[model samples]
Target chain A: MSLGGDWYLALAAIVFSIGAFGLLVRRNIIVMFMCVELMLNAANLTFVTFSRMLNDIGGQSLVFFVLVVAAAEVVVGLGIIVAVHRRRAGATADDLHILKG
Target chain B: MTHLVGPLVATTFVDALTFTVAAAIVLAGAVGVVVARNPVHSALMLVMTLFGVAVLFVEQQADFLAAVQVIVYAGAIIVLFLFVIMLLGVDRREVFGRENLRGQRPMAAILVVLGLAGIFLLGFGAHWATGAPSVAGRANAAGPNVAKLGTSVFTTYLLPFEATAALLVIAVVGAVVLVRRTPGARGPDDQDDAGLEEHPGADGGDGTLAFGTGGEASGDADDGDGGERGDLGHDDPALGSTHERKMTS
Candidate 1:
């Protein structure tokens, strides 16, 4: 098939679905965090593809900010994981039900 | 060879080949990420996916983005993931198909199918976005895309750009504070208990004498141990130099 903006956007969508699936099904919080990252990447790809198709500078510039946001998110999210793991031996999502009644 | 009349055709062929390879790598890596039982393996798969996306970016002529993708996403973000994986010791094989919540798998499956179908519809079923014939910039074809990106960022989008820098600094400092373990921060009781778990071999080696005479071999080894030892060593019935030497701190 010809590689077009539509093709790349479709790939992004599929990848995003896979990430969301993993996020929902997996109990391991670390893996869930990985899934979140994957979703972010998929979004980034879509942004670049749309930018290329539109011939606009704005989409690509937006991608630069997205990268920074992703980096910051990684730092914070993994830090939370470390903190949770320190208190509890396991990082299972099941163990994080302390707030529940 | 020097007078070849097919330079443009050669580039198109090369682009098609690269796209095929990169797309395959990305899809395979995405599958690997979900299917892999071990989180560490999943992390490696994520690296593969990130690399493939970088290739895709380069193909789109986003040279600076391709570099940033590899450097930031693969280099830093995924490295942080691996660190958490190793530190947390969550690398053990995940119990497959085990759902802590009822209907979680079914829900996820339905959501996945819906999501994919909707996205496909957005792409094909509808004539979707109003993408023009082609971008005027064409990235490097017009001028250096990065230079163009810099000029816009500093001009039109300066406020958000500065805000992002501030956001990153806060994230860095906050993460450091959250993960750091300062001495005497936690009480002696929890500290000693955590110490026992920290050194499993020490717990097993020091075994019965570590906890209680009636302590089970592996039971005391796994549970919150080092309590009796802490009491004996710190302020209780002085158990002599041997017990004191055994203390972690």
Candidate 2:
């Protein structure tokens, strides 16, 4: 059987789902950030697969900017997580109950 | 079968084999990231997953993306994860049963399962992606994955290119604003004179204020406070008091 482009897309979908599942279940802020990075990678895979299938370079082009945005996002997100963890006694997800109301 | 096998068949065999191996690694590492107890171990597992995805990208002819994947995600981001883990002392196994929200785990499982179903419907059960998005002729004129991407980004996507640059600067400045301590910041020791009455919001006020003077406090801690331990808790008065008690004992 020929390996069609759809196989790559399906793999990306599975990875994306795994990332989503991790994001939903995990409590640690850092782990959540890793999950997000995982999701982004899956989306990048989809984009590149479509790029190859369509013989277009634009999807690959979008992946470049997505990488930039992801780097900036990680910088800002980790800063927040670090700040919150430092302010509280424990870094558990439960410790962020200031907005419990 | 052997007589009919040609170069084309061999090429397809290699592609399928590579895809199978890479996909297996990616999925296994992703599952490990979810199930691993130690945050550092999970981070390492995430590195494995990223590397696998990079391999897939290379296979798909996104060579530049594969390089960037290794450099940016595996190189820089994983280092940041390890750094935060070391700084917070959260490298050890974490307690998983200590969820803050009620039914958080169950609800998460349900939502994630639904999300998976949705993705399946889109991926396997749909025909939407049969057509690839059309590209402008001028955009594909540069040739090759890397060069064509460069031309398309600098020309057709120039507006977004400049926009994300601004977004990156904002994110950098925001991170600095969030984490960087101010000069001449107050310390918990200084608040002893004022007392908790004056600053009823002293805990938060002190937490941040303590970080302001954290540079000095950290220096002091490094000078054999608990024999060089408890330096990270230098900014928290609660932890600092506990350290004092520990020292006395």
Candidate 3:
């Protein structure tokens, strides 16, 4: 089967947009984090698709770095979440307006 | 004969169908993250979404990204979220608030639609078809998956790699320091003291004052007595005479 076309790329883009919507509109912090992951995965999907389409190793290499950044993001973001939870007892992202200035 | 080829073709078709189903599940879970009310439940749904995406990645021949997505995103990060949820003793009722801003949700929906339209237009409508060599040639020629990634990361991208490590170290140190209570930090210790007082007669080694009125009086007595023995019980109505006996004896 011939692979790497615009259809799957469009689908990934739409999914990523939904995720961005969730990240924007959602008040819950953890769900927002999940949404962020969704967006990242969408980008990764595009990268892999294009990598296959072009037969370039660079896009795949970039996917590796993106994965690395995503891991680091999870580590740091969850650490912040835990810190906020410990300090506030329950870290609702809505409650994160302590520094709203 | 042709009958044997039919079974093999059927198996491959079934595998494709299975992969499609997995992809659908991942998409649904992404939607669930947006729609779910309970943050904990949403986080759990996100784990399913991540798993589905990993399957899709595997289907796309991105084995490394798939494993990293599952292991790092689903296993470690989501578990950290669950741990925080449990540790903070978050009640379900406390998480949801019924306050939709004026026209915010609809506006957000509209913006998302527009952004997606833009991306689709750019992705599909744009006439930029630059075909390079086919994947088969590269896959046959390179023959080293992890080694290629490692070489690029170490040699060409080494500076950024080390910088990322520094960033991670800083993040770890910052989170640790943020969560850690200093020796004299009053808030966390005060809460712990309140918890200690909840279980009356428990051996709180630091002699934390009890919570209520009698304990307040005891605290005052201890503060005034200039470092005497049995100071915590000195002002208690029950222990007053016993302390006096000890002082006289």
Candidate 4:
């Protein structure tokens, strides 16, 4: 038998926390996006864990959809980042104040 | 001691060892992603974490997910991230010592710690998996992992599967539209127009059209400027008048 489900859940929680911390603290938009990926991966791990624990294929199916959404999000997000970089050469997340009215 | 530890540890030694090693790798990579000053290093660390997760997926009998995780997350996603990083030339090391907002780092750390503690408490204290077992299908049913997953996707979750296909198409189109450079399009900073006009040769004479860089001159030659007067003839008349004034003075 594999290890208890709680072990995987605890690990996922910790990884998610680390990702959240990085998202909040990091200034660079790219690093922040990486943090979002980390969080999503952690959630994926949790889903797989529950899939095994419950003997349900639905959890894994949800993970598949999540993977698709993540890919779409990354594509659009990186395109936006490229557009932003073109406008201001070295602009960080803090420097994006064009919408401030 | 045997009775207390028996339920927690895996019955097989290999199972326990694999979980221990992969969990360690995942945690270490996650921390590295957060701490690495360079975005490239963070992306590499994310790959490591993804690989470790894939290993765990295999261990949990999620063989199809394991392969997809490796191929999609580590392969395509990380390469795209590195590509963007290199293309934008933002791979330089970031200064982590300086904090722009006062007490923001500490506050974020504290919030994450509290949230983690809450998750742990809620998870262990309550019954975690309280649901009807195998609502869609049994994961442990006697079949190959891929076949089982494919059957479920095509039968039970067909609508969502089709929706994801549409989502992917939309994402592709959206990315192209966002990154595409339009001629005479003004950004928030209007100063780039002056810079491009002054140094037309710097951008190879077509700087005003192609993203203000003049890297390529293949598409949309209708507004392509042949000389100084052509430079002022932008699609936007207001912008054209502004360029005319700048050229005259």
Candidate 5:
């Protein structure tokens, strides 16, 4: 038998927590984006684990959709990053305060 | 074959060992992604995490997703990230010791720890699998993993699948629009125009700056562009008005 679902779930939780912490603390927008990817990966791992636990193909299907969405998100996000970098070289999340009212 | 064993049976030594190793790789890569000073190193660390997740997927009999995780994530996505890092030349080591916001790191650490504890409690406190089994279809049914996944996606989740296609097309178009630069209309005060002459289309012209047409179009429509332009805008109202005047005339 394979390891229990709880073990995988616990690992995923830790990874997700780390991703969230990195997202909150990191100032570099690209690194921040990577952290988001890490969180999404953790969620994907959970879905796959639950798919095994529940014997349902739906969880995996949902993960497939998530993969698509993540690809889209990354593309647009990086495009925006490139555009921003074009205007202002080496600007970090901390440097972005133009929207402050 | 191994999955056929009932969950009640104790896990084999090999299974435990594999899980232990993969989980270690995953956690180490995750921490590396967070702590790496250079963005390039962070991207490489992300690849390690993705590979570890892929191994876990295979362990869970998600064979197709394991392959997809490797191909799409490790192959395409991380490469794209690296390309951007190299292209933008932002791979320089960042000073991690400096804290722009006081107490931000400590607060984030506390919040993440509390949230993680809550998730663990909630996950383990009750019966983890409360829902009916195989409501969609049996994942471990006798067939190839790809076939089962494809059948489910095409049959039960067809609408969502189609929507994802649309989403992908929109993303491609949005990316192109965002990165496209308008020729002529270089800002005289803009200091970073040193390399602008390299692009064949970017002929130097009047001092009027062609602010991102992507930003302007998004600002006008207020669609998904607001989120992309969250950090972008002319801070000075006078410069903004001048941009507007230049655009109109």
Candidate 6:
């Protein structure tokens, strides 16, 4: 296939879907976090690809914000995970369900 | 040779190499997260995966995003995860092994296959427009990258930017409260018994009595008359003292 705008966008979409699949199917929370990162990076790829295709800078600009969001997310999410581990003494998500039902 | 390897071949090679490396890293880390017996190892693998994806971002020319990916995802965030793991003391003894996959694996596999197929179909079918209106050249493509980002962050997207700050504050507060000990918290002994799974040979040779009748054997050796018998010696009795005379401590 040619490396056209559509093709690039399609590649990004496929990668994003794969990440989403991993996120849904994986039981491990840390794996889920990795999958989430994959999904975000996929979106960033789409942004950059479109930026190059359309010769625009806005899509690229949005990517920076996305990066910031990802960072903030990691900080808070990892904090929660740490808190959970402290309370439970292990980092398994299965242990978390015990508190619910 | 150089003529034979045209820009197309070169570009294709770069793309393929990038994709292969990125995919392998991601998949390996994902598998590690599931298969690794140690949760700490799994978390580290997750960091590796994040780093891999960041590299892919760089390949795609998302420079700003790549930097964020490294600093926020791999650097600061993974360190936070490490901190939590350390505070919990989850190593050697407390790691939970992988749960056996009874019926979940097959269904998960099927779903993944279907998802991939759907993505392929979407890609092949969509009629994507090529020439969209150019928004800007590429965000922060000039000198002072951070300044460009800062200007855009505060100028057009200030509202969302402020909201992000608020979210960060909440996360900080949440972490502090979650890990904070109470003013009258009990000593280490009084702390709740958590994640104390039975592991063989955890405390090796700590001078504690072993589980057996060995104590009876030693008790018989230290009879009441043994003390008086030692008094008969003219010397300090240190010369004739055997290895058993030394305390385990």
Candidate 5 residue-wise lDDT, B1-249, digit = tens: 122234435888888889999999999999999999789899999999999999999999999999999999999999999988755556545667778788999999999999998987777566645676575689989999999999999999999999999999999999999988776645552443223323333323443233332223223222222122332233332244345435533
Q: Which whole-number lDDT from 0 to 100 does residue B102 have in model 1?
A: 82
- Best-fitting candidate, measured by TM-score? 4
Error of 4 at B55 (Å): 0.4
Candidate 3 stretches greater than 4 Å from native: B1-19, B91-97, B127-140, B183-249
When sorted by DockQ, best at the front, the candidate numbers are: 4, 5, 2, 1, 3, 6
Model 6 over residues B38-129: C-alpha lDDT tens digits? 55786787777677767666665556767887887677767766654444333322222344455565676678778778766765676465
Q: Which candidate ranks first by DockQ, i.e. highest?
A: 4
Per-residue lDDT tens digits for candidate 3, residues A1-101, read 32333534765786798799998787667778889988988888788777655666566677877877777777677777755544443335666776476
Could you tell me the TM-score of candidate 5? 0.81
Report the C-alpha lDDT of model 4 over B51-166, residue by residue, as the tens digit.
Answer: 99999999888999999999999999999998887555465456567677899998998999999889877775667456765767998999998888898898999999999999
**TM-score of every prediction relative to native:** 0.77, 0.76, 0.72, 0.83, 0.81, 0.63
Per-residue alpha-carbon lDDT of candidate 2 for residues B85-179, written as tens digits (9 for 90 to 100): 65544443456765657898888888877887887666555566456456533333546667777778888888999999899999999999987
Alpha-carbon error at A69 in model 4, in Å?
0.4
Q: Lowest-scoring 10 consecutive residues by lDDT in candidate 1 chain B?
A: B212-221
> Candidate 1, residues B1-249: lDDT per residue as tens digits?
111233334456777788779989998898888888779899999999999999999898788999999998888888888866654555645666656678889988998999899877656656555655433244434578788778767877889999998999999999999977665465333554334234335434554333321122112222334112232223221233234234311
Please, what are the lDDT tens digits per residue for candidate 3 over residues B59-132? 66666767788888788878887765544334233233444466767788899999988876666556565575
Worst 10 residues of 3 chain B by lDDT: B1-10
Question: List-wise, what DockQ does each model earn?
Answer: 0.47, 0.48, 0.32, 0.54, 0.51, 0.24
Question: What's model 1's TM-score?
Answer: 0.77
User: Which consecutive 10 residues in model 4 chain B have the weakest lDDT in total?
Assistant: B214-223
Candidate 6's C-alpha lDDT?
A: 0.55
Model 4 ranges off by over 4 Å: B1-6, B188-249
Docking class of 3: acceptable
Give candidate 6 misplaced runs (Cα > 4 Å): A1-28, B1-35, B91-102, B128-132, B135-151, B182-249
The lDDT for every candidate, in the order shown, is 0.71, 0.71, 0.62, 0.77, 0.79, 0.55
- Give the candidate order by descending lDDT: 5, 4, 1, 2, 3, 6
What is the Å distance of residue B242 in model 6 from its true position?
Answer: 31
